[model samples]
Target: MSVGKRAEPDPYSLPVPGLVRRVRRIAGISQRELARAARISHGVIGRIEKGTSMPTLPVLERILGVAGLGIVVVNDEGRVIRPMLDRADAHDGADRRYPSHLDTILDPEPGEWWGDIYGLARPPETFHRDRSRRDMQRRRSQWEVRVARHRHEPPPPKVPDYY
Candidate 1:
C-alpha cells in the first residue's frame, strides 16, 4: 500500500514514556501522587506516559526531580551529555558574579543579530505568540481550502440499478 510523505519514527522516542513510567514505579508512587509532587496534573502525567505530549526541558526536570530522578541525556555508550546546562555555566569564574557571553549575545542590545532577525532579542512572549498565531493561521487556511473544494464538487446522482 502507498503512504503519504511521513517520516519514519525514531526508535529512541519509544523509550521516553516507558522510562518515565518506570521511574515513577521505582519511586513507589501512583500517577496522581507523582503529579502532585511534580506540581503538574495527573492528566499531564498520563499524556506524557502515553506519548501524546512532549514536556519542555524544565517541566521534565521537575517531573524527574519529584520521582527522585533527573534527566541525563546520554549517548548509546552511556556518556552524560549536558549541552545547554554546560553552556549556561561556561564562564563562571572564581567571583561567579559575571554573566557569560551568551547572556550578552542573547540580551536585547541595539546591535544584536537576534533583535535584527526577530525584532526583539530575548522576549519569549514574542516567540510563543508568533508560533501559536502561525499554527492557527495554517490550520484555518487548510480548512478554508477544504470547504471551498467541497462546495464546488457535486454529489453523484442516485443509482437506479443495484449489483
Candidate 2:
C-alpha cells in the first residue's frame, strides 16, 4: 500500500454493493432467493451484489420490502427526514408535482400569479429566482421590523404640496 492516508467511508452513506450485500446478509437469504421474492431476474441480484450494476430506488425498495426492511432518509444527527405531502387541489398548470425547493402557494388570489398576466395555459405556480426571492424576503423582514417598532403610531400627515 502507498504511504498516503487511506480514505475513510462516510458513516452516513453506504455504497451500492455494500448495501446490497449487507441487506442480503441481514435477511439471511441467497441472491437467488432475494431475486425471486423481489420479482427481478436472478442475475440482477448477483450483479448488484458484485457491484457490476446498481439497482434503481424502487427496485432496491422492493427487495428490502420483501425482506421486511425499509429505506429511510436520515440526517447527520440521525433524525428521520420525512417527505413532504402535496396539498389538496394544489397543482401547477401542468398538473404535475410542484418543485420541492420552493414554497408552494395554494389557492392563489387574483393578480397573485404571473401566468394570468401572460394568459399562458401553463402559467406557473410561478417560482421566483433565488436572488429575487432572497431580496423580497430581506425587504419583507425590514418592513416587518419597521412596522413592529411603530405598531401603535398614527398615520403620518399628508404632504403639504398635495393640499
- lDDT by candidate, in order shown: 0.60, 0.68
Candidate 1 regions exceeding 4 Å error are 1-14, 82-163
Error of 2 at 62 (Å): 1.4
Which pairs clash inside model 1? none
Task: Report backbone clashes per prediction.
Answer: 0, 0
Winning candidate number (TM-score): 2
- Residue-level lDDT of model 1, residues 39-96, one tens digit each, is 8999998999999887777888888887678766776599997664444433333524
Q: lDDT for model 2, please.
A: 0.68
- By TM-score, how accurate is candidate 2? 0.54
What is the TM-score of each predicted model, taking all chains together?
A: 0.42, 0.54
Q: Which window of ten consecutive residues has the lowest lDDT sum in model 1? A: 123-132
What is candidate 2's lDDT per residue for 1-163, written digit by digit as tens? 1235657965335576777777788889888888888999989989887777778889989888875878898877999999988764557656777776665545545554556567655343554334455345545555566997767766443322110
What root-mean-square deviation over C-alphas does model 1 reach?
20.0
What lDDT is reached at residue 68 by model 1?
75
Best by lDDT: 2
